[model samples]
Target: MESLANLECFVRSAETGSFSAAARLLALTPAAVSRNVAMLERNLGVRLFQRSTRKLSLTETGEHFLASIGGNLHALQAAIGAVTTERGEPAGVLRVSLSPSFGIGQILPLMPQWLARYPLIRPDWQFENRPVDLIAEGFDAAIGGGFALTPGVVSRTLAPAHLIAVASPAYLAGRPLPRQPEDLAGLDNIVLRASRTGRVRQTVLRNAAGLESAVQLNESMIFNDPVAMREAALLGLGVALLVVPDALPWLERGELVRLLPDWYVDLGVISLYYPSRTLMPAKTRAFIDFITEHFEREALARRFRAGPG
Candidate 1:
């Protein structure tokens, strides 16, 4: 039988697409991860990956193998969790991955309460804009926007957020305010590089006639951070699109004016995602419940609602 260690190595390597990354996550060298995967392949009598200088692709046999064993692996983990829960208190390291903005706005504020409630459970947090591989990265949970939950991980919606376009009143004072979506084609824009996917930021704008046009923005003063972009927009640099939760305060204070009130992009729900709860560690379960309860409370929920424009 293949060893559990080798099986884990295979899964990690597959999920990360890099031997070096998987090695770092597992606290081992790349050569060690490669060896474990090789041993597993030998035991199974089939190659699992096609490797090149630039990329790693799974073999057909490897895909089938993963599909066949994935459920069993999760079940084994769940069994171990059940035993641990029955014995005593839950105490272990829980890793969480989240975007920097959400981390700053939501999760960080409530972390102290979580720490006080579960003093025995330690947490490792990583904040970034990139997509994370939960299983390969060894993360217990992640908070993020959008609905693109990867296969094998489960996701639960925590809240809803919308994207809005805004600019400073001084910037719009002399310039002809856009009456139609196409009018923005020639205007200066403050684009966020971190939020752009591929070559453009996909935006939908509504004209006075209530007609919506899908605009692909490729030109702008691009910034890597949202806060910086919003600051620049506040200084009359240009129009910018930001999430309602992040831009509402500026709008209420009259530092920024909503450019297009009738049109906005629905970024869908912000969610807390994790591996199956059947095998979830006690610390992770507690944190998830705490966050869910916090958002459900009337006072806290009101704080998230879009304020006066």
Candidate 2:
């Protein structure tokens, strides 16, 4: 039988698509991980990975082998972790993906408290703009909006992605303050072009009364990023529809003012996604509980709702 270490090296390498990343996770040198995988393939008398300088891909046989053994390996790790965790706190490298703006502004602030409770657990977090595949990419969890519910992945909603119109006081100095959604048409509008679709994002404003109205945003400046739009608005460029989280700090600091506060657009829910496995890692479970508890206690979901203050 091949050694468990070799199998682990192969599996992690496949998931990360690189020996270096797997090495970081396993605390092994890249050369050692490569050697272990090579040894495993030689023992099996078949090629597993189509190795190259730029990328590594699995062959047909490798794919089948991974499917057969991946679950079993995870179960074995979970069993070991369960036994170990009985002696002390959950400890390991916890790999998680997060949206850049939200993670930095909201979640990162909670880390000090989290670390105080679980000092042994180490966090390896990546701030990304795009949705990540939790299982295939080997992420323990991901926090973002609009991620598709792929097979073997489950999500817990954190907040409604409510969008509200905002502009700097400088921008609104001369222009009339918008009393309603339609009043925004006369002002210069800074807009976001959808990064994935390459088209301008459309907004339909809705209020507490269940009434919806469309606003015609005259694009004076266009951006493919929310941060850029916020900055443009701060520079007195134009009115921009911004997600509540993105607008909250500026709104609180009085750097930007919310317009037509009674109205908002519900884009979707920001969610926390994780693999739907039978035996999840102890570290992951602890992290999830900690984050969800924090959200509830802080009433962040309700705070994220855009309404009259």
Candidate 3:
């Protein structure tokens, strides 16, 4: 039988599309990954990859080989997990990636409880506004909002993300409140542009008269950070479309007010995403369960229901 180490290297290289990338992910050298793949190919008596100066492509044999072993490999991983769970407490490094704002406002504050509960687990956390390549980056899990997930990762919703249009009371004080969405054309709008795709600035609004219209505003300020957008809106720079959780403190403090509350967009759901559970490390599984339980039992649930305390 081919060594499991060689099989693992081959599978990782195929999934990531490069020997160097697979090596980095596996904490092995490029030569080591290449040697393992070559060894596996020799053992199987078939070429696994078409090597080139520029790129790598799987051979027909390699494709069939992967299909044949994938299910068995997943089952083997699951069996290992079942054995480990039945034995004792989980232990290992749990690597996590999350969006900056949510990481700061939501997850970080609650981490102390998680740490206390799982003394055997150590966590390595990264925060960014961009999506993480979980397998490539060696992260066990990611917390994110917006954007469709890449294939090969599993995702579960943690909360519903509600985007609201908000501006400071001073900005709207004596001005005719945008009774209809079309009236926003005359208002200054703040745009959050985290991704290159830019932010959505159009909104649909219904007036008290039950008349509905679409409003598209020209942005007066474009910011990549949600916190900065909130500050600009507070300074009366313009109106902003903000996620409710991030805007809650300002709204409660009377620094900002929601506009067109009835008509707003639903950004992608907030989720806790991870690689397939079958290969998940014990520490990762524990962290996932902890986060899931904490959100349900803590202030997060209430905040989502009653609009940020």
Candidate 4:
């Protein structure tokens, strides 16, 4: 029989394509992970991976082995998790991925309250802009919008990912506010270039009346990140399209004014994503419940909607 630790080391190393990355996730030294993997390989009597200074590639046998054992390992973990949950408090390193702007502005504020409820759980969160591979990257959960639904993962939508046009009050002063999407062409537009596509995004604004219009803007400034766009708009550089949560605070503070308030671009829903296991880790379940409860109690879905304002 193979040790579970050896199997874990092999699987994590394969997933991350590096021993150092596997070590980080397992909270073990790289040398320890390497030795465990070596032990597993010795037991199997086969070369599992082809190692190099720059990369690690799986052998054909290793690929077959990984595919065969992956689901079984997860099932075993689920069984263990079920027993562990029944015995004690929800506690562990809760690894999560979050979008930089939204996470800091909205979810970060709730951490103190959440920690009070589950003090045993240690938070390990990565603030990133791009969508992450939940299983491959060993993320327990991820909070963001525009993530593709991969196998074995499910999402719970927290709010609408609607983007509304905004401009600093200083920039809007003495300028005619946009009453329609087409009117935006006259203003200095701070636009986002899609990070994956490397192309400027075309804005199509829709109103409550189901009226939709393709917006033509001056495109005076371009950014690859929403956070940068928000900051540029705050500095009175130009009009920017921002998600409701990102712009809400500035709008409330009178620093930024919503342009074409009745119109917004719907990208998708901001969602909480986690692996769809038969029995989820207790820490992950607790964190998901905490966030969902907070969103429901605050009516954030309604507030994040940009249809009326």
Top of the candidates by lDDT: 4
Q: Candidate 2 versus the native: TM-score? A: 0.75
Per-residue lDDT of 9-114 in model 1, one digit per residue for the tens? 7888888988888777666567767888887888788999998999987899988887887668766555445333444656567678888877876678877887
Count of clashes in candidate 2:
0
Which model, 2 or 4, shows the larger lDDT?
A: 4
Model 3 stretches astray by more than 4 angstroms: 1-87, 198-213, 299-309
TM-score of each candidate structure, all chains considered together: 0.66, 0.75, 0.69, 0.77
User: Model 3, range 91-189, lDDT digits (tens) per residue?
Assistant: 666789988887898789877888787766677889888887665455778998653465446888877676677899889988877754666678998
Give the TM-score comparing model 4 with the true structure, all chains together.
0.77
Across 12-82, the per-residue lDDT of candidate 4 in tens digits comes to: 99999999998887766677678888888988899999999999889999999999987688766655454
**Residue 172, candidate 1: alpha-carbon lDDT:** 92
lDDT of 1: 0.72
Q: What ranking of all candidate models by lDDT puts the best one first?
A: 4, 2, 3, 1
lDDT of 3: 0.74
lDDT of each: 0.72, 0.84, 0.74, 0.86
Which is the better candidate, 2 or 3, if ranked by TM-score?
2
Better of 1 and 3 by lDDT: 3
lDDT per residue for candidate 2 within 36-110, as digits (tens), equals 899899899999999989999999999999999887887665564442345668877788998777888789998
